[model samples]
Structures are given as C-alpha cells and as structure tokens.
Target: MAARSVLVAGGGIAGTAAALGLHKAGYDVTVVEAHPDTAEDIGAFLTLASNGMRALAELDATDAVTAVGFPLTVLRLLDDRGTEMAHGPLGAADDPALRYRCLLRGELNAALQAEAVRRGILLRHGARLTSVTDAPDGVTAHFADGTTLTAALLVGADGLNSTVRRTAVAPRTQPRYAGQHVYYGYTDGHTHAATDGPPTPPDTRAITMVRGSGAAFGYAVSPAGRTYWFARVAGDPLPVGGPGHRTARALLPLLRKDPTPAAGIVEACAGPVMVTNATEMPLGTPWHTGRVLLIGDAAHAASPATGQGASMALEDAVVLAKALRDSPDPHTAFARYEHHRRPRVEHNITVSGALSRGTRTTPADRGDDDTLTAQLAWDTPLPAAPGEHA
Candidate 1:
C-alpha cells in the first residue's frame, strides 16, 4: 500500500512534533502554518517538566532542546518578605533523569520546527486554514490564500483559538478564562540579586516562588545572567490590554508592595511585557470528527500555572500518532487517543486551577490541598509514546 498522507495545521510544538511522529510512523506529512515567521522569538520562557522532556526524547529532539535550555530541579516557595515558607525537590527527587527544564518558548519552537524540516517534512508558512471538508475516505483543507490540500487525515495542532478546531472538529469548544491575568518580562544586564541585602542564592536553576497578598511572583535566573520573571494577578479576562512595558508599569505598584526581588526585576526589564489572561478549555470536548482531529491547546488548554501545557501537547502528538499507526481508521485512532489522555488532562486542569486560584487568593483561603498539588507535580505518570522505551 502507498504511504498515507497527513495534513498538520499550525507549526508550533504540537504540530511540528506530530509531523515528526507521523513521518516516523511511515506516513507522509505536510505542515501548514498561518504565521509567516515561525522563527520569531515571542513569549516568555516556559517550563518543560520531566514528562515533556521524555516525550521529546521519543522524537529524537531532546538533544537539540537540551542544547538550548537549562535543567531545573529545585523549587523554593517563599512569602512576600522573601522568607522561605517551604522548599522541595521537583519530580520524584530520586530520579535524577526526570529533572525539570526551563527554556525560552521561541527556542523550543525553533528546535522542534528545525527537527521537522531536517527530517524532510514540507512546511508551508503564511497559509491560514479557513475551513476543512471531511469525506469518508479523506479530508480537504481550504486555506485562506485560495489553496487547498486533500489528505487521508487532518490534524489540528493549532493553539487555543485554533482555526481547524473552530471549523471542523468541535465548533462549540471554547477557551474559558481562569480568572487571572499574567505578565512576563525578561531583563538584560540585570542580575537576579537586584534586591539589596544578602545576595540571591548561588544556584541558578531553582524556580523561586514568592507569594504576595492575592498575587504571586516567580523568577528563575538563567545561566546567562538574565532573570525570567512573571506576575499573576486577579483580573477580568476580556478586552486584552497594553504593551509589555505599559503592562509592567501598571503592575509595578503591586510588585513594589511585594517585598521580594520581583519589584527589582520588573523595574529593570526592558520594553515589551507579555500580558494575557490565563485560560483553559473545558474537559470532555470532542477531539475529532470524521477525518479531522484536534491536538494540543485546540483540544485542551490548561492554565500556565500547571506547567503542564507544553508537556500535555507533546504527549498528545505522540499518542495520536501511535493510535493512528496502530488503529485501522481515523475514528478509532482519535477515540483511542482521547481515551488514554482525558483523565490525566482533566486531572491537571483541576490541579492547575486550584493552584492558580491559590495565587490570587491566600493559601489558607484556598484550603489545604498541598498533598494533591505535590502528587500531581511529582507522582502523576505521563503516558509513554509509541516506541518509547520503558
């Protein structure tokens, strides 16, 4: 039989990862990205927990990713006064290989995209998917540029506001605001020890969490002497507002009130602060219809607080490819994919939601759930990709 051709939409992490996996599974794959430049370094750095790194290894992209990122293992929690509240090791603590990682979002995307291209996958930029028509044997994707491609399967790896998801898979599925707004600003020439007094810890890989009144700040110093910091505040989700600098200015007062290094970091960052509301998709949304399927944020977007968004997306791509390679049809493959993923995704939603709420409210106000949070962070097992070694 001739190799099956698959069309993957949105060339971000999930899309590129899916292309690689499908090609490895003996299927022809082409990726269409609406954005003209996939190389642009946009957005703040993100955390790729142990599970996500393992998934990248399955695609043979771990070496490339690790080359450009830092390995993180310890997370320190502190109060607004910079006093240590509690400190713990990330992951199982015993398994050193499962160390947490922090990397620039753009670098990770670039690495994944480069890996896809290196494997001879065709990637088309500036092609926005307008609609998708499904047939019993195949699916036809119509691009906004008056171009169309027919393939045996259509995979929506687009992010939260996915066009493929809105047009074909589940029109009614929407991203709901999680009642928190976030800001991330990167500083150049500014050290993490911006605050006066004792110098910050020598360890650069620790993720420091500082809790203020109804708000939280997190900063991780990169090996390059740059500090990646973020602030989460309770706010309205709609009518997105301001450039990064302006947003940073607006949130400065709150940070000034905070007695941690956050105030200094925010004050030192250059222009362009990323401001957006935290959001997540409702669980139980259908992930596929006919020959079309949704992966990543299209199917389930988790709050960034969970730190599992990227990991979940990477997992989705690998598992979906496995199901397609093993099952006889698209429906069965998508069903199997969802069956194996929904429980964990939903569980993360709850875990992340509670954590996010805790940031906006007091920990005591949020109730005692440290045990649940710890289990979700360290004990929950991510499913292994097809062909991944145990």
Candidate 2:
C-alpha cells in the first residue's frame, strides 16, 4: 500500500500524542480537536505511572511533562479507621522495571500538541468530526461545520463519549454508571502527609478507605505540588456546580460525613471542586474497521476504578502507531492492534473492578474496603515490545 495521510480527531492527551506518533512515522497528519486552543488550563492533576511516561517519551514529550510534573515516591494505602495497610516505593521501589509520574492533564496535552506541530503536523483546534467514510484509497471526514477533508486513515481519539466510536463501532452501548459518583479537584500542597507544615511529595501517601454503608475518600499528591483528591458516595448524590467557581455548598456536609478523614481534608478544600458523574463503557472487541481506527478511550473506555485509563490509552497510541507503520495493509494493522490491546485492557478493567467491588461496601481493610485500590497502588509499565515490522 502507498504511504497514506492520516487524520486524528480530538486534541486531548491521546489524540495529540497520536498526531505526533504518526507524524514521526512520516505520515502527513492533521489533528482536529474540540478545544478552542491548546493553551487552556486543565484544573485536575493526573498521575502518569512510569508506564504512561514511557509511551509519552516515544512522542518526545515525557521530559516536557516531567518539567510540569514530578515522580511519586510512595503509594500509601490505609483502612477506613486510618491505619496503614500497604506502603510501597514507586519506580525502583517496587520493581526495578517500575516507574511512576504525575502531571496536569492540560499541560501534558499542550506539550504533545507543541511537539506534534513542531514536527510539521497540522493541528486544528475547535474542529469536531461528525462522521467519516473510508474506502480502499483513503478516508474522508465530515465536520460539524459541514466541511469535508480527505486522508489515508482516520483516527478516532475523540474520547469516551466519542462520536467517532459511536458511528464506526455501531449500536454502541451507552456507558454504564460506575456504582459510585465522584467528587474531585486539585490544589497546591507540598505536603502529601496528612500532617500540616512544609512537606515534600511522598514516595508514600497517607491514603485510606473506610468500610461504610456510605461514601469513600481518596487523597494523593500529584506530580505537581497540588494535593489531588476525590470522594465517592454510594449513589449519584453529587454536589451540583462547576469547578474553580461555585460548588453546591451542600456538598461539603455530605463529604464531611465521609468515613475517612481524607474526606474531611477534601471538604476543607475551599477552592475549586467538581462533583463528577463518572461513567465507563465495558471493554469491547474489534477495536477498528478499515482505514479508520480507535485509540485511547475512544477504543477501550476503562473504568477509572482501574486507575489505568490514562495508561491504557497511552499504550493504545503506542501500539496502534507501531502496527500501522509495519503493516502494508491498514486492515491487518487494525487487527493486530486489537489483538495486542483488547485483551490486556479488558483484563486491567476486570481486575480493577474486582478490587472496587470490595471498596463499595467497605472491606476488611478500611482503605481497601471502599476506596479505589486499583487506581492508587499498582502501575503497569508501557509495553515496548518491538512491533512485528520494527
């Protein structure tokens, strides 16, 4: 097959990274993102495990991300009564192969976009792909603005509620509500320790999960100096309001009643807060069609319970780009991509969920009982297996 031009939809972390990865492979690439510009601030901080950083490193943005973020020393786990359960060092701490980093989602996205554009890739912000049609020769994208563009392959990096996935994947199932509703936000805090005073981001965290008929609280110091936090109530009683602005005043009391004291710290957070309705689509087979393919949440929407949503997405980008570069036929590349990604992603979600089921009702371990264990403790490194072509 002749070398093909590629179109990537979405400007978020995965989309921007895909644009850069494909461009490095010498494909004429264009990225269409819904965000007006890449400069917008992402209020929330995300933990980029050592594995996700490895994938980003391939796109040459790992250092850029680290510039804005930092490594985590420890992941401290606790029971609801706030007693330590498990504490392990990250990176060389667990396995010599293990590594973990944290970052602001927006900053990472910005870095990838800059690198993508630096490499001569076209990145169009405020562009939303409405639909796509593919043939043996190329793929054509129809935009919401009624504009059309052609490319050799179209990548659906749009996201969990991805329109690209909906149209291409067919009768796409509606995302299921995770049993818990989450309240989350970020603020500056050098001390990851529960105690006050000057603090350093810890190799270990003061984290807990109290078994209760009620909500669960989670706290951690992200790569950035901010203390990132979240809480989950049994049903969907989320505090109404947006972040960095006005939040439902009623939310504090509800969160205050949380079993873990971490919930109180989150409650004390007087800055910005968002009561989010977290949802997920179970793993699906056949991650692609012909010239159009899926990456990240657009392909495998993992339950955040696994804390591998970003990791899985990053891995998808790495594997997909590698497969495309090697396979002469786009179809073959798509199949191979699915084979490599689908099973692993499905397993990650399943195992994380099993741990979460224990969290919902409270467990033998206070932190393990209702807290999101999978999200905090373990990290999976990026799969750097040489592509069949490489």
Candidate 3:
C-alpha cells in the first residue's frame, strides 16, 4: 500500500518537528508555512529543557539542534537583594545530548526545518493556510495564494493563533492573557558594568533567575559575551495597537527597585526592548475533528513562566508520531495521543498560568520523570487509550 499523505500547517518548531516524526513513520508529509523564510523572530530566545532534547533524540535530530545553541548546565536563583538564594545543576546536566539548551527561536526553527528538508520531506515556504476542508474521505487545505492540497490527514502545528483551530477545530476557543507582560532584550556584556560593581564578566554556562520585587527576571550569557535577558511583569495586557518597540528606560524603573543585575542589563541594551503579552490557550479546548488534529500551541499553549513551551511542543511531536505508527487507524492514533498528552500539558498550563498570575508561591512538583521517559522513547510501544485493548 502507498504511504498515507499528510499535510502539516505552520513551519515553526512544532510543525517541523512533527514533519520529521511523521516522515520517519513512513508517511508522505508536506509542510506549509506562511513565513517566506526560516529566519523569523530571531530576537526571541528560549530554553529547551532536557525532556525536549530527549524528544529530539528520538527523532534522530539532536545534532542538528545542539549545533546552534549553547548548553546551560547550572541554574542559579537570586533574591531581590542581589544575594544568591539557591544554585544547582540544570536538567540532566551530565548528559551532553540531553542537557538544557538556550537558543534563539528563529535559529531553532531553522535547524529543525533544515533537518526535515535533509531527510527529503517536502517543505513549502510562503504557503499560508487560509482554511481547512475536512471531508469523509480526506482533508483539504486551502492556501491564501489560491492553491489547495488534499491528504489523508491534516496536522495543525501552528503556534498560538492557529488558523486551523479557529476555523475548523473550535471556533469559540481563544487564547487568553496569562496575567503578565513579557519583555526581552540583548546586551553586550563586554561594554556594560554591573550596577554595584565594576565591569564583571557573566557566567557563560549558568542561567540566573531573579525574584525581584518588581518582576521575575532571568538572564543567560552566551559564550561570545552577549547577555540575553527577559523580565515578566504582572500587568494588564498591552493595549491593542500600542507601540511595538519600547525603550529599555521604561522598564529600568521597575528593575532598579531591586538590587539585582536586571536593571544594568536593560540599561546597556542598545536596541529596542521587545515586549509581548504572555498568553495561553483555554484548558479542555478540543484538539481534533474528523480528519484534522491540532498539536503544540494550537492544542495547549502555556505561559512562559515555566519556560517549557518549545520543549512541550517537541514532546508533542514524538508522542503523536508514535501513536500513529503503532495504532490501527488515524482516529485511534488521535485519541491515544490526546489521552497520553492532555494530562501532562494541562498540568504545565495550570502551573505556568499560576506562576504568571502570582497565585502560586512555590513550584509544583512535575509528575514522574520515568513515565515521561518511557512515553517518549521511540522503541517503546505507546500505551492503549482508555477502553482499548493493550
């Protein structure tokens, strides 16, 4: 029998990783992306925890990603008084391939896309998805440029504000503000001095988080001496159509209230300080209908507080692929995938949202690591859905 053709919408981290997984499962996968090129949102950076790395390992694409990003081995926490409160090794720090990695969002997307292309998967840039038509036999994707493609399955890996989810899956569901405004920027550490002391070099391999009086701040220095920093402040959502480019000075007042290094890092930023409202999808939103299914942010997007957005999406790719590869049919695959993923991703959404809203004081315990390891293991057979035979 001919391999089933699959259509994947959006070509960012989630979409590309899903394409890799589906192709590996013997599906004829084609990816459609609205962006004209791979280099979009280059300024935004994120950390992929060890679990995300393990997912990449299952897809055999670990080297492609680790090549571009620097590993973070240690996590340090500081109080509002600039005093160190806790320090420890980051997730799986001893395992080079599974260590936490900090990467620019665009670079990571490009790396995954490149790996998919290298594996002979069809990837089309500038292919904007306008709507989806799900028929009994197959699903059809209509593009903005007056083109269409039909396939046995449609996977929506688009980020927040996914077209597939809005038009097809659940029309009423919308992303909600998670009670915080996120700001991030980069500064040349070589040119900036600490607020309380002379020019001190940054800890290259350590990511420092500050519990400031004004905002929650984090920073990681690259090996090249550039400081990548972000601050999340609890506030009303930025007014729609407000200024996109904010000055670092506007945020300095908040940072200065605490004696931490956040203020100095913002002050030294020579470029525009980028700001975005932390947002998340509503819990229990539908993820599939007929031949169409949603993955990544389209299905479950949590706030940035836990720093697990990309990692969660990577996990989605691996699990979804395993479900399809092992299940008897696509419907069973979708059901089993959701059964396995909903609990974990929803837990993240709840915890991260609480952290963003200041409703949670301490970090909640993430469920068993061993179970997740087995779930993402490519060779391990995915467990059957409730009411299904083993």
Candidate 4:
C-alpha cells in the first residue's frame, strides 16, 4: 500500500515537529501554516525539558534544535529574601543531548520548520486554514486564500487559539484563565546594572526560581551574560482582547518587596517586557472527530507554571507519529494516541493550574519517568492499548 498522506495544521513548534515525526514514520506529510513566515512571538522564551529532548531525538532533529539554544543543567531555588533554599541537577543533566535547553520561542520554531523543509517535507507558508471538512472518505482543509488539500488525516498542532479545535473538534470548548499574569523580559548584564540594588548573581547555567511573597519569579542567565526572567503574579485576566503593550515597570513594585534580584533585572531590562495571561484548556475536551485529530496546544494547553507547554507539544508529535506508524488504521492510531497522552498531559494541567492558583505548594512526584523514557524511545515498540492485542 502507498504511504498514508497526512495534513498538519499550524506551523509552530508543535506542527513542525509533528511533520518531522510523521515524515520519519514513512508518511507523506504536508504542513500548512497560517503565518506568512517562520518568525513569530519573538519576545517569548521557553525551556524544553528532558522528555521533550528525548522526543526530538526520536524524530532525529536533536542537532537541529540543540544548535540554537543554550543548555540548563542546574535548577536553583531562592526565598523571597534572596536566600538559597535548595539546588540540584536539572532533568537528564548528565546527558548533554537530553539536558534542558532555553531559547527564544521563535528561534526554536524556525529551527524545526527549517529542518522539516530541508528533509523534503512539503511545508507551505501563508496557508491560513479557514475551515476543515471531515468526510467519511478523507479530511479536506480549506484555506483562507481559496485553496484546499485533502489527506487521509489532519493533525491540529495549532496553539491555544487553534482554528481547527474551535471549528472541527470542540466548538463549545474554551481555554480558561489559570489565575495569574505572566511577565517575561531580558537584561544584558554587561551593559545594564543595578545602581544601588544588591549585586545580581554571576551568569551560570542554573535556572533560579524565587518564592516571593506576592508572586512566583524565575530567571536564568545565559552563557553570554544575558538574563532571561519571568514573574507570575496572581491577578484578574488581561483585557479580553490580548496583553497590550505592557512594560516591565509594572512588576518592579512586587519584585522589590521580595528583596531579590528580580526587581533589579526588570529595572535594567533592555527592551519592552512581554506579558500574557496564563491559560489552559478544560479537561475532557474532545481531541478528535473522524479523520481529524488535535495535538499540542490545540488539544491541551497548560499554564506556564510547569514550563511544560513546548515539551508537551514535542512529546505529542513523537507519540502521535509512533501510534500511526504502529497501528492498523487511523482510528486505532487516534485511540492509542489519546489513551497514552491524555492522562499525562492532563496531570500537568491540573498541577500547573493548582500552582498558578496557589492551591498547591509543590508538584506531585511523577512516578512515570521510566515509562515515559520507554515510550519516547524510537526503537522501542509502543505498548498496546487496553483490551487490544499487541
């Protein structure tokens, strides 16, 4: 039989990574992105945890990603008074390839997209998906520019505001605020310094998390003496439209109250501070209907408290491809994929939501590390779904 043809919606981290995985799984994958180009949300930065790195390795795109970002091997915790509370190795810190990595969201997206294109995957930019038609035979994607493409399956890897999820899977579902406003910014230590404040710590590969009285703050200094930091403060959601042009100055007061370097870093920020309301999808939202299925943020978006959004998306790509490659048909593949994914991602959403809402003090122990390691291993066969023969 001929290789199955799959159409993936959205060209961000999740979508592009899905293309890479599907192509590697011996499928004819075509990626359609609404954006005119690869550049997007240049201000935001994120860390891909160890599990995400393992997923990238399974897709054979680790080098493509590792080349752009800096590694983070240690995690440090500090109290509101700038006192060190605890410190330890980050995820898979012993392995260079599997260690945590930090980089601009746009850079990571560009790297994945470029790698996909280089591997002969058909990636069409500016192909905005206006709607989707999932017939019994196949699924057809309708573009805003009056173009249409039919494929055996459609994967929605679009971000939080995914058109595919809203139009096709769950029209009534909506993302709810996770009870905090997140602010992130960058400051160059070489040029910017706190005039009278306490001296900021030297640049290390460690990500420092501050337990403030009013907000949760974290920062990591790059190898080049640049600091990337974020603060999550309890607040009402931003205006319904979006995070307007908010500056870092608004956070100075809260940071200063904690006696930490967070305030100084914000004061010395080199450019505009970006802010967004932490949002997550409701549990039990439908992920698929017939030949169309949702993955990544479109299916399950958690708050930034866990820092697992990108990692979860990357994991989604690899597992979805594996399910399709191993299953007898699309229906089995979607079922297997959901069976394996829903529990883990939903746990993240619940934990992160609680943390954001101040209902939880610490993340629960994830006892599934070994199981996850096996699942992301490319050479390892995926486990059969419950009540199905292996």
Candidate 5:
C-alpha cells in the first residue's frame, strides 16, 4: 500500500516532531514553515522535563538534545533577599538519566530539525500557509508562495498564532493575553565577576527561582559556564514600541532594584534581551474537526509558569502520530489524540494560571511550596504509540 501523505503546518518544535514521528510510522511527511529558516531557534532556554526527554528518546533524538544542553538537578525557590524558601526535585525520580534538561531553544530546534532531515522527512521553508480548505476526504492548503498541496491529513502544529487554527479549526477560537510578561537573556559566566558571597559548588546545577515584590527571577548555569536567566513581571500587555524595545542597559536598572542577583545577570548579558507577553488559549472543547487537526500551542497554549509548554507539545506530537499509526481511520485517530491529551494539557493550563497569579505577590506571602516543580514533573509514563513496542 502507498504510504499516506501528510502536510504539516509550521516547522517549530511541534511541527518538526510530528513530521519525524509520522515518518517513523510509515507515512510520507512534509513540513511547511513560514520562516525563511526553520532551524534557527528564536526563543530563550526551556526545560525539558523527564517526560519530554522520553518523548525525544522515542524519536531517537535525546542524545542530540543532551549534547548541547545541561542537566538540571533541583529547582530552588528563594525570596527577594535570595533567602532559601523551598526546593524540589526535577525530572522523574526513577531515572537519573532522564532528569530535566536545559538548552538554548534554538539548539533544541536545530537538533530536532537535523534529526528529521536525516530521517528523510521533507521540510520546506518560506512556505507560509495563507488559507486551508477542507474537502470530503482530504484538506487542501494554500500557501503564500502560490503553491497548493492536498494530503491525506493536515496537521496544524503551527504556534499560538497559528494560521491553520484560524482557517481549519474553529475560526472563532483565539488566544487570550494571560496578563503577565517575561524578560529573558543569556550571559557568559566566564566573562562576569562572581558575587562576593560564598561561591556555589562547581557541580551545582540547580535552577534558582527568586520571588521579588512584584516580579520573579529564575536562573541556572548551563554547560560551559553559561548562565540562562529569565525574569517574570506582572504588567498589562505591552503597547506598541514599549519598554520591551529598551536597551539591555536601560532595563537592567529596573531589574536590579530587586534583592536577587538579577542585576548581576543583566550586567553579564551578552545577547539581546527578549520581552514576551505570556498568553494562553481559552480551553476549547475538541482540538480537531474532520480531516484537519491542531496540536501544540495551536490547539492549547499555556503559560510558561508550569514549564510544560514544550513538553506538552512534544507529547501531543507523539500521541497524534501514534493515533494515526494505530487507528483504523483518520477521524478515529483525531478523536483518540484529542481524548488522550485534553485532560493533561487542561490540567497544566489551570496550574500555570495559578502559578502566574502567585508571581504577582511576594514569595513570603506565597509561602514555602514545591507547587511549580510538582506541576513540572510528569510521573506517569506516556502511553506507547502503536509503532513503539513496550
């Protein structure tokens, strides 16, 4: 039998992972990305929980990911004064190798894209989807490049502002601003002077979270003496040409007032600072309809407070591909994918909102808790996809 042809929209984490997974399941997969280059990582660092590592392992890309990333052991919560408040374990307890992995968002995307290309999956750059039309049996995607492709299935792995979501899924479905924003940048530890206090152990790789009056800071040392840091502050959505465009030096003063070492991190930053409005898609009932399906941020976007946004996208890709590999029909497969993933994604969404709210208050008022770490860890094993053997 001829393999089913799948046209995936978006070439980010979810899109690339889905392309790889579907190809592994005996389907011909092609990914279309709007960006001129899909391999470039556009965001900051992100933690891949144990579950996400397992999903990458299933796709045979874990080692590639770990090669460029660092392993994080514990997540430490502190106050504005850098006083220890609470700590919690990261990753699944049973597997030491599966502990949380942190890497540049670009590196992760590059690794995944390399792996997918090596597996013979086709990826087309600069092919933005202009619109999508559903037919009786398949869906036709119209691209801005004046190209059209029809396939057995179309996967909307595009991101929060997914064009496929608007054209294929419910046109009414939309993403809402979560009323929080984050500033992130990276700096080289080797280039900066260490704080005068007691030096942390060389082997220490714990992620530190410090709660300020109305903001929160998180940072961890990555491999090669690099510091990855982010600061979350409560504010209305940024207006056009707002402080986000301010120079690193300009923003440093605002963040330095906090008692934590955010000032030091800012002073050491060697790259451009990024400010993003944290947003979440209002939970919609059914993530799919007919021959077209949505996955990743396109379907259900969540705040980064829970740190499961990337992991959830990985999980969604694997499950959706598995559903296609196992189910007797496309409709059935889409239904199964939505059913299995909705509960978990929804839970993350709720918990993320709660944590985001907590960031608005002082850490002392929040009290000592491992809520973030617990929410970040995925203890249960993901159900094996059809092609993956137990």
Candidate 6:
C-alpha cells in the first residue's frame, strides 16, 4: 500500500529523516535541499531527550549515535555565583535501563544523512522547491533550477521560511517574533569561556536552566562533550544580519547584563556569536493539500525551550510512513496521516510555547510543567529493543 514515490523538500534533519523512513518502507524517495552543500560542522549543540533516541533507533543508527553522542544522567540548576538551587537525575542515572540519549546536532545529522545515502535515497543539494502541483495521479515539484519531477506524494519538511509550506498550504503568516532573544554556540567541551578561568558550574548533560526574575538562560553539554549555551535576553534578533560577528555588535546593548550562566557563557563564546530569534509558527492551518503534506517546522515550529522540535518531526515521519504503508490510496494515506498526527502536533506546539513563555521559573514551579508525561508520549520505541516506547 506504500506510495510509488515521495518527494521530501528540505534536507535538514526533518526532511532527510522523512525521506529515509519512507524509502525504507519500500517507497522510492528523493530529498531536495536548498543548501548548496553540507559539512560535518553544523555549529550547534542539541539535546535529544529520550524521544529523539527512539527515532534514531528506528533507522537502526543507534550505534552511530552512540559513537558521537553522550547519555544525560542528571540536571543541575545553579545561580549567578554557582550556588546550586535544584538538582535531579535525568531518570537515567537511577535506572541504567532508562535512556535519555543526547548528541550534537551535527553528529546526528551526519548519521541520518549517511543512512539515507546508503539506502539509495536520491539526495540533492542546491535544489530549491519553487512550486508544487498535486495532480490526480501524483505530485510534482518545480525547482528553481528549471527542473521538475513527479511523485505519488510530496512532503513539505522544510523549516521556517519554508518555500514548500508557502506553496502547498494556506501560506501561514510570518512567524510572530518572540519577545526575547538569545546567543548560542558550541565549545570544544565544558572549557571555561571566562578568559581561561575555572570550569562553569551546574554543568551536566541534562538540559540546564539558569533562571532569573524577568529573564532566563538555558543550555547544556552536547553529545560530543562540547558545551552549548544560550543566553535569553528580553529583546528580538538584531536587525543587522550578515555574519555572527556583526550581529553580536548590534546585540551588545541588549545583552549587557550578566545574569547567572548567561554572563559566564557570553564571556566564553570564544567563537562567533549570533543573535537568536525566538519565534513560533502560528500552527499552520490545513497542513495538507491535494497530494502534499507538511511535517517538522513547516507544520509547527516548536520552541527550543521545550526541546521537542526534533522529536515531533521524527514522529511525524514514522506516523506518515506507517499510514502510507497501511492505506492503498495516496489520498487515504494522507487522510490517515492527518487524523493521527493532528492532535499530537497541536498539543506539542502549545506545550512548547507555554514552556518558552514560562522559562523564568523552575520546571516544578512552571504551571505547564508536564515534562514527564510529555516525554513518554513523544518518544518512539526502538525497533531493535524487545519492548520500548521512548
């Protein structure tokens, strides 16, 4: 019942994962990326939670994941002077069976991308989706390079500013700017950024939250043992956009205060620091069209604070591919995909928003602190494991 072919627009973690999943289901898949090329260094650290690991497991790439990433066993919260306020195990330290697998975004991306290539998935870089036409038989994607191809279904797995999203759906409005901004980058490890000072405090693989009265900073150690830091200040992305250096100059006025870990990390960024934007996709309505469907950031952009953006996207790929494998007709498959994924995706969007909005408090103090239940439902089971969900 799988579709004959699928076209996944965008080559990021979401799009490539979808392409690989669909291809493994016996459907011919092609992935089109707007980026001209790819590199080993993506320049950002990512926390996988338990949910992300289960997704990678489905691809049977956990070994590769283990090679590059680390396990998160505990979370520590500290104040400006390195005073511990809250500390807890990441549910894994207590039970070694529990897996809160965390890794670098680049490392995971490389694993997924390599698996996709090994499976004969057609990978294209520098191919921008210009338009999409869903016909009675199949969907066709028109690219900026004056080329076109047809497939049984099309997936708009593109991220924010997604061209696929704009052409296929109701064309959701520009993302509303989140009121705060951040500066994030990766370090070789937990090396102190304060002019070669002592190690930073409350450091762990668990996603660390350095909270304050009106603002907060959230960050953690990535899989590669390199530290990742983000300082969330009350502002928006700097207007000037060229490179990270220029943006940092403009944001200097906005990020003057050293609030806890934010102050420490900012001094340590050592490399180029860019202004970060906190924005949300209004939850694009009608996430589907004739033969086109949306997934990942194109359908809904999860706030980084919730840390479920990648998890939800991976789930979308699994659910959508399962629907296609179960239904005979592409339309029926598309319908089933929407029916099963709609509620879950919407709730996640809301949860991510609420988490970001309430960042100034500890997880227990936050009104919408349902991280425990949220984690279980979101994590997909590892196929190799006898019994596991997330």
TM-score of each model, paired residue for residue = 0.87, 0.80, 0.97, 0.96, 0.86, 0.81
Q: Higher-TM-score candidate among 1 and 3?
A: 3
lDDT of 6 by residue, 161-195 (tens): 77777876757555655555555665554544332
Between the candidate structures 1 and 3, which one is better when assessed by lDDT?
3
lDDT of 4 by residue, 51-148 (tens): 88988988999999999979999988888787879899888899998999999999999999999999999999999898999888888999888989
TM-score head-to-head 3 vs 5, winner: 3
Name the lDDT value of residue 370 in candidate 4. Answer: 89
Task: Give me the runs in candidate 3 sitting further than 4 Å from their true place.
Answer: 1-3, 190-194, 197-199, 365-368
lDDT scores of the candidates, listed in order: 0.75, 0.62, 0.89, 0.87, 0.73, 0.64
lDDT string, candidate 3, 80-169, tens digits: 888889999988999999999998999999999999999999999999899999988889999988999899999999889999998889
lDDT by residue (tens digit), candidate 1, 1-390: 133889999898889989987887778999999888765446677888777766666666777787777777788887877678877776634544446778888888888888888999999899988999988878999988799999988899888898888889788878888878888877766545535446565467688888876467887777877778888887676474542334477778887775677787788887778877888888787888998898888888877776788887877777677777776477667776777778777777777766776643332111113432322231233343454332
**Candidate order by decreasing lDDT:** 3, 4, 1, 5, 6, 2
Ranking of all predicted structures according to TM-score, beginning with the best and ending with the worst? 3, 4, 1, 5, 6, 2
Q: How accurate is candidate 2 locally (lDDT)?
A: 0.62
Candidate 4 yields a Cα-based lDDT of 0.87
lDDT winner among the candidates?
3
Clash pairs of candidate 5?
Answer: 41-106
The reply for model 4, stretches above 4 Å from the true place, is 1-3, 190-201
Of candidate 2, the 10-residue stretch with the lowest lDDT total is 362-371
Clashes of each: 1, 15, 0, 0, 1, 1
Task: Tell me how far the alpha carbon of residue 273 in candidate 2 is from the true structure, in angstroms, after superposition.
Answer: 1.2
